[model samples]
Target: MSLLPDSAVTSAPGLRRAQLLLARQALEAILAAQRPADAILQDLFRDNRQCGSRDRARISELVYGVLRDLRRLQAIAGVQADAGALCALRLLDQGLADAATLEAWGLTASTALARRLAGFDPATLTPAQRDNLPQACHERLVAQYGEDATAALAQALRGQAQVDLRVNRLKATREAARQRLAQEGVKAEPTPRSPLGLRLSARAPLQNLASFREGWVEPQDEGSQLIALLVGARPGDTVVDYCAGAGGKTLALAAQMQDRGELLACDISAARLKKLRPRLQRAGVNSVVGLALPDETALAKFAGRCDAVLVDAPCSATGTWRRNPELRLREPDFAALQALQLRILGDAARLPRAGGRLVYATCSLMAVENDEVVRAFLEQHPEYVREDAGEILRAAGADWQEPELRLLPQRHGTDGFYAVAFRRQGE
Candidate 1:
């Protein structure tokens, strides 16, 4: 593909070409579906030890920018969707650079191509292309939220996500954690929704901060914090995080229990359970008991015992598109995912005793993964009745109007999340 005119194809010097080459390599690897964009970039940086922080930053910016706006960039760049042209088009489209400066970055595009990009019209592309989402994703979102709202949601996800942290209440109060982060040169403000959450204005090396290393805070989205809150696991209550992958919610629930009650963190992977050991110690939590279940059937041991059971079932993770844009490019089997979600929710529901709270949640925007799964599980389990999630969240200091907790990026300034609280009936 001839994206560059003869005049624009000059030999750019060493550093510029190297940056462009690295960016292209990362983008190609991501598009090839080998691994996540972030992982690919990590490998690239590790292999090229000479790349400084600034070089890594530039390469990452280009790679993510292209992924976030792949379909739109493809529409603008036409058939010549090579890495150089797409990067050049993305830069120009973002007003980051002009056509004249493109050659300096070792990105070249023909004058006509540049002109077409400058006057690119969204009307010329299909709705899916305009939204830069896969056709199936766009259709599902549109079916649920209508066209205009889906467009807004898609656009919201195209931007970068803020770095939010959940202050580990066992270690320190939110205010104390904020003060500690400030001392480490990281600025943060309280999130609008989550009472114990802090939102960073920009990305920071949080792992290096003394507060983070001391377990004063954990990197969690504000929406995720709210999900934990919805569980309403109080002191001395037996709570179970039924699908604790890395134990993020398990730690939060443990803190809510004030290190008093029995908090069981269950997952199918022992490897993932192992990762939570140090985090539990760092947060000074003592109530959590990490359990690796052989499968969903293993939950039978806790049947009709716990006061609260949280099923954070895995799905397509569509709500995390802002952080993982590649999700928008790939299509997941919604039917299969919904089946798995229902199976897990049903298995977990048995753990909650009569009148106990059972909460189901997912980091997904699709109804099949969220509302549909909840509806299916409730239909099969007559003892469980859906409760108003908004009421629970409101009582916990976060005001939500809907019956369920639907945290959207376009509205909530956090990652997408859907949660519904249920109550078991009868003895």
Candidate 2:
């Protein structure tokens, strides 16, 4: 096949090819063991110094897109379809691949494989089987594209997610950030619930952007911003951001307090806390006192002193699957994560003084991680009562409402998040 001119390619074809290769490598790494896709992508980009920005973007997109739809694609192609073959099928479905492209890459498009897909009927597959299919198949195309057995195998594939940023209110307003971003050729709109949130129309290289460099905005999901908002850290309040990795929400809390509160940001990781220092400085957040805890014993020093504590606990980040689609591939292990959740909750709860509020938040969609964890914590500490998360947000001046403060991408155009606010019964 003749090589098309630069204009004929939707994206750079050369970059696409590099991305496809890296994506296959990433899949192989995942099959080897559980690893975060973002970390893997960063390592890949770092190793291949020759790869440019466009190549990195294309590779990351292809890798994540395939991961998100791996099961549906596998079911369509047949259960035993390996990662490489499945990725090829996804490219074909997206019209990014053709016979000539495969041939040019020295890949032989097996006639048997093509024939099997040609005769597949997706209508016959069960819902479970369909869900088990690869991530590349679309719901609408289930009938036409997955004819033969492929149609029955096609499941709903999650679409591309927008990049969200939380405007550093300590440095700039949401409107001001939007205007600044516009000057940099980045289009963004205000998020519904977050006073300082903006959702970018498309993912752009932000590392070099002036707004980011100036710390006017921080890359954070809208749902995440809402979690910090639920904390209700008013000026002069003493607050602790437990497990404040890199101080994303901690910084947000500092902003909300208008730099008048004493915000102690504590994390187990010294390295992560060190990184926050520069960011805190750039955001002009002077109220946050970064503390690197050696262990639980170190956290106990601040026990019963904080007026509010925000525990953005660690969990399987299932709610963020849209941005990092590879999360759908994780095998759910409720028992292990539940135990860790209990530990974090108990530890974080210790920091709050009597009558103080504690906001439990997770980027997990699973009830086991969110509601169950909160329920168990409440059971252990009868002194604490569940404050209505919705009520807290309303009091904070949040317009977009929900009963449980749960945010789902399909419903709210944000990452899946679950937050619960609690207050101690009496001082």
Q: Pick the candidate with the highest lDDT.
A: 1
- Which candidate has the highest TM-score of all? 1
Candidate 1 lDDT score relative to the true structure: 0.85
Question: Across residues 347-422, which tens digit of lDDT does each residue of candidate 1 receive?
Answer: 7887899999999999999988987887778789999999998889888887677888998999999999999999
Error of 2 at 187 (Å): 1.9
Q: Which ten residues in a row have the lowest lDDT in candidate 1?
A: 1-10
Compared with the true structure, model 1 gives a TM-score of 0.90
Give every collision pair in model 1: none
Runs in model 1 deviating more than 4 A are 1-15, 95-120, 295-298
Please report, in order, the local distance difference test score of every candidate based on alpha carbons: 0.85, 0.75
Task: State the local distance difference test value for candidate 2.
Answer: 0.75
**Model 2 — TM-score against the truth?**
0.86
Model 2 misses residue 183 by how many Å?
1.8
